[model samples]
Target: MGFPDDTPPGLAGVLATLRGDVEPSSLWATLVDLAIRGVASVHCCKGALLSGGKEYLLRWNESSSLAPWEQEAIALLEGKRKGTEREVSLLSLFQTLAFGSKGYRKALEGSLEGAGLWSRERESQRKRVLLISLLLLFLGLAAFVVGLIGADAWLGLPGARAAVAALLAGAGVGAMVLFLPYLLVGALSSSLTDQGYRRGLQWRAAAKALKEELKGEGFNVERWGGDRFPAYSIALNLTDAFQEAVKKGKITAAPPWFSTALADKAEVVQFGALIALMTASSTGSAAGVGGGGCSAAGGGSGGAG
Candidate 1:
C-alpha cells in the first residue's frame, strides 16, 4: 500500500481493499507476508514473455498439470469469451495481439547472468584472503626451523665444544640480522603475488562468458517473470587444465609437511597411535607388560668398547 506514486492507481486501489480486511497495525506484517509468499509458477499455460529490443519474442511451454478450468480462467482474465481452445480459431477472429508468451524468458536470463558474476567475484576474494594467511604462517615457520637445525648441528661438535658454541652463536646472530628479515620480506612479496594471480583478468572474462551462455539458452524469459528471482546453475568444467597448472605450481611452492596446522594436528594423533602400537607389539613378543626404558643400540662399529 506504501508503494511509490508510479504504481498504477487501479493496482493501488486493489491493494488498499485487500489490506482493509486486516488490522490497521498489521499492514507492515501483511506486506512482509506477501513478500515471503512470492509468486510461483502457477500453470505451464501461463508462460513468460521476453522483449528483445523492438521484436516481441514469445516462448510457450505447456505444463503437464494445466487444466481446462485454469485455461478458462486465463481467457476470462484476458477479457475473452468462453468458447474455443485452439489458437487458429482465436487468431482468425482477432489479429491485433502485440505480445506473445515468450517475453518473460528474456528478462530472467539477464538477471541470472548478473547474479552469477557477482557470486564469482565474491568467491575469488575469499580464496585470496585464505591463501595469503597460509603463505605467511608457512614461511615464518620455515625460517624458525632452519635457525633451530643449524644451531643444533653446529653447537654439538666433538672435541671443540667452546669453538663450536661460538660459531653457532655467531650463526644465530647472522640469521637474526640477515636471513630472518629476508625470509619475512620474501614471504610478504610472494603472498601478494599469489593473491594477485587469482585476481587476474581471466576470472572476469570467464564470468562474462557465463553471462553470454545464459543469454543463449532462452532461460531468461520466464525466469524473472514472478516475484522470486530465477537461478541458472552453471558448472565450470575446467578440472584438467586448472589442476595441471596448480600441480606445476605445487612442485615449486608446496609447503612443508609440518607447516600446515591441520597436518600437524593429525600427525600428533598418528604419532601417539604409532607409539602405542609399537609398545604393544614389543611387549607381546617379550611376554612382559607396561614397563619403561629399553636401551636402544646406536648404529656404529665399536667392537671392543
Candidate 2:
C-alpha cells in the first residue's frame, strides 16, 4: 500500500523513527523530506563544515509553513527559541539534532501513535525479545540435560528409541543455536505492532523496487521524479544505494528544493556521505551549553531554549 494521503510533512522521518535506530540518518532523511516539501534546500559547499572538506547546508524558505519538527530543527540550527533563518550549516544542523534527538523522536512517535500509525515501545520491545530468548535457552538447556541423562531413553522405547532421543537432543541444541542470534538481533531491534510490521514490509518492498530500478538499463529519473523518491530512499535507509545510483547518471534535473549548483552524481554522493556522517559525532562535548537542553548531535552547541 502507498503512504497515506494525510501524510505528515516528515513522512520519511516518521518511518525512520519507526525503524528505532535513531541514527543521524533518520535526521538526514527527515531533512530531505522537509526539503521535498519546500521547507528547505540542501546542497554541498566546500567551506560548509571544515575549511577543506565538504558538508551540507540547508537554506530555509520563510514562505513555507513549517511542521513542528521542522520548526524545532530550524530553531535549533539558528540558536534561537523562535524565529526564521535563510541558511544553516549541517555540522551545526546535526548538532542541533543530537541535542534534543530523544525529545524529537518521542514527539514524532507520540503524534504518529496517537494517530494509530505507530506502536513501538523501545524498552518494552527489547525486554520482550530478551524474555523470549531466555525462555528458549532454558528449554534448550533442559532438553540437552534430559537427553544427556538418558531421561528420554529412561522413558524408554528400548534400543531404537535411544537413537530417537539423540535426535531430540540435536534438535534442542539447534534450537538454542538458532534462537541465540534471533535474540541478539531482536534485543537490538525496535518492536513493531502487527500493523506496523505489515507497514514496514510495504516500505521494504518499495525500497527493493527502487533498488531494482536503479540497477536496470537506461535508468529513468523522470519516472520517479527528483525529490519525492529520493526522500523515500533516504527515509527507507537506502542512502548509500541511492547515492551510488546517482553516480551512474549525469543528473541535471535537480529539484528546485535541493541545491541547484550540484553538477553530477559525485556532488550528490558528496552530500549523501555528509548526511551519513550525522550520527558519528552526536555524543561530542556539550561545550556551548545553555539552559534548555541545547547541544549538538556531534559538535555544535545548539538546542531549544
Candidate 3:
C-alpha cells in the first residue's frame, strides 16, 4: 500500500484513521478488526511471522555478520518444516530477528550509538566553555577594581592608601551582587542540559522530555529517523529550547551580571574623572577670588596711608 509519508505507515496509520475531526474513535473498532485479522505481524517465540495462513518467504539479501540467533531464525523460517507451529520466546525473537535484512538493525544501532557518544562529548565541551567564561568574568572584575584603586593614588586623592581599600571592598560587594545570580543560572541550566543527553533517546523523546522538564507543559513527540530530525550532532542545540527558557527566567530573576559589573565600573570612572576636573576648576576659581581681594585691599591701604 502506497501510504503517504505524511501519515504513519503501520501502527501510525491506525492512529490517523481514528483521529478524523468529525468522528472520535469512529475507526476504533475497524482498527481492532484489522489487527485481529492478522494484518499486523505476530510475535512467536523465535521470530515474528506474517500470520493469516500459508508460509510466506522472506528474502534475506543482507551482508554477512548476521547475529548467530538471526541466522538460526532465518534458517528455520526458510527450511522444509516452515509451516509447522513452533514455540518461540519473546527474548529470542528480538535478539535474533531481522526486519528486512541484517543491515537494517546494524545501521540503526550504529547511528544511534554514534550519536549518543557525540552528545556526551558535546556536553563536556559546553561545560568547559561556560566555566571559562565565568572565570574570565571574575578576573575582569578584579582587574577593573585594581585599576580604579591604582588610579586613585596617581590622581592624588586624600588618604590615597585608604581609598584603595575602600574601592576594593566596594568593588567586591558590587561584583558579588551582580554576578552570583547569573552564575547560579548558568550552572543550573548547564546541569539540566547535561543530564538530558546523558541517556540517548530518539530525538522526539528527548524533545518531549525537555519541554516537559523545563516548561512543565505541552510538546509533540516526534517520529525519529524521518525528515526534520533533531540535530543529534550538538547536544546543546538539541536542548536549546529548554536552555533558552531557563536563560530567560534567569535574566528576569537577575539582570546580566558581567555587563552590570562593567557598567558600574564605568560609572565609577566617570565620577572620578568629574571629581578630578572639578577640583582643578575650583583651584583656579579660588586663585582668581584671592587675587581680586588682595588688589582691592592694597588699593584701599594706599589711599588710607
Candidate 4:
C-alpha cells in the first residue's frame, strides 16, 4: 500500500503528513515554512504586490490549484487550540505576506469587483422588476373594482353586464400573465444578488485581514497614491530576503512532513485516496480510481503544503 516509487510528494502529501499526531507548535512552524515557500514562489514569478513602492496593489492573478492550499493552511493554523504566541504571530505574518503577493491580490480584487458589480446590477434589476409587477397587480385590481361598480348600473341594459364581466376577466388574466414572469425574474435576480454579495464580502474580508495582519507584524503599510490598483503596499522585510533565497535554491523547500516518518503503508494509501476525493470535490475534477489515488501526491515537493 506504499506510494509507488514514481509518486512524488505534493501538497496533499504534505497535508497528510501534518495530519499525523504531531505537536501543535511543530505543525504551526511547518505551516509557516510552507507559506514562506509559497510566497517566495510567487515573488519569483511576479514582482511585489506594489508598483513604484507606492502605487497599485499587485496581486496574484494566475489560476492554480495551489491557491486553495494556502487558504487551507491558514484555516488549519487558525483552528489550532493550544497554539503558541510565536505560532500565531508567524501564521499572521505568513498570511499577510502570502495573500498580499501581487498575483494573489490581483485575483482577490478582481473577484471582489466582479462580485460587487454583479450584485449591484442584479439588485437594481430586481427592484425594477418588482416595482413593475406590483404596479401591474394594482392596476388589475383597480380594473376589477371598476368593473364591479359598473355591473350594477349595466345590469339593467341587455347583455351589458355580461360584456363588462368578460372584459374584466380578460384584463385580470392578462395582468396575471404579465405579472408572473416579472415576479419570477425578480426572484431570480434577488437570488443572484444575494450570492454575489456573499462572495464579495468574503473576498473583502480576506483583503482586510491581510492588511490588518501586516500592520500587526510592524510592517509600514501605506496607501498607494498613484493612479493604479487601489492597494496598500508594505515595507520590505525578512520575507523579501527569504523569497530571494528560495528563488536561488539556497533554502530547500521541504514538505511539512519532511521530518515525520511515513505512516503505515495502508494508512498512507487511504489518506492519499481521501485527499484525492477532497481535491476532486473542491475542484470538480473526476476522482481517479485505485492506483490513481497516488496522483494526489504526484507533483514535485515544493511551494506551500
Candidate No. with top TM-score: 2
lDDT of 4 by residue, 73-159 (tens): 444444431322212222223233332233332333233335342333544566788888888988887777677667655766886
Q: Candidate 1: lDDT of 71?
A: 32
Cα lDDT tens digits, model 1, 229-266, are 11111011122222232233311222111111123234
Q: What is the clash tally of candidate 4?
A: 10
TM-score of 2: 0.58
**Residue 86: error of model 1 in Å?**
34
Which 10-residue span in candidate 3 carries the lowest summed lDDT?
Answer: 286-295
| lDDT of candidate 4 at residue 273, scale 0 to 100 | 29
TM-scores of the candidates are 0.17, 0.58, 0.21, 0.26
Candidate 3 local distance difference test against the native: 0.30
Off by over 4 Å in 2: 1-21, 48-55, 62-64, 80-86, 95-100, 120-189, 222-226, 260-305
The per-residue C-alpha lDDT of model 2 at residue 288 equals 23
Give the 10-residue window scoring lowest on summed lDDT in candidate 2: 296-305
- lDDT string for model 3 (1-305, tens) is 11123311121211222211111111111111222222211111111233211111112222254433233333533342223332222222222222222432233223333433223344455466568658756865785677566765546556666566566657666765676666665554321123223332233344455545445433322332121211110111232442343344421221111011123234323222222222222223211101011111111111111
Number of colliding residue pairs in each model: 18, 5, 3, 10
TM-score for model 4? 0.26
Cα lDDT of model 2 by residue, 8-96, tens digit:
43544445344434444555556666666766666554342223334445565553476565565555545632344355655565456
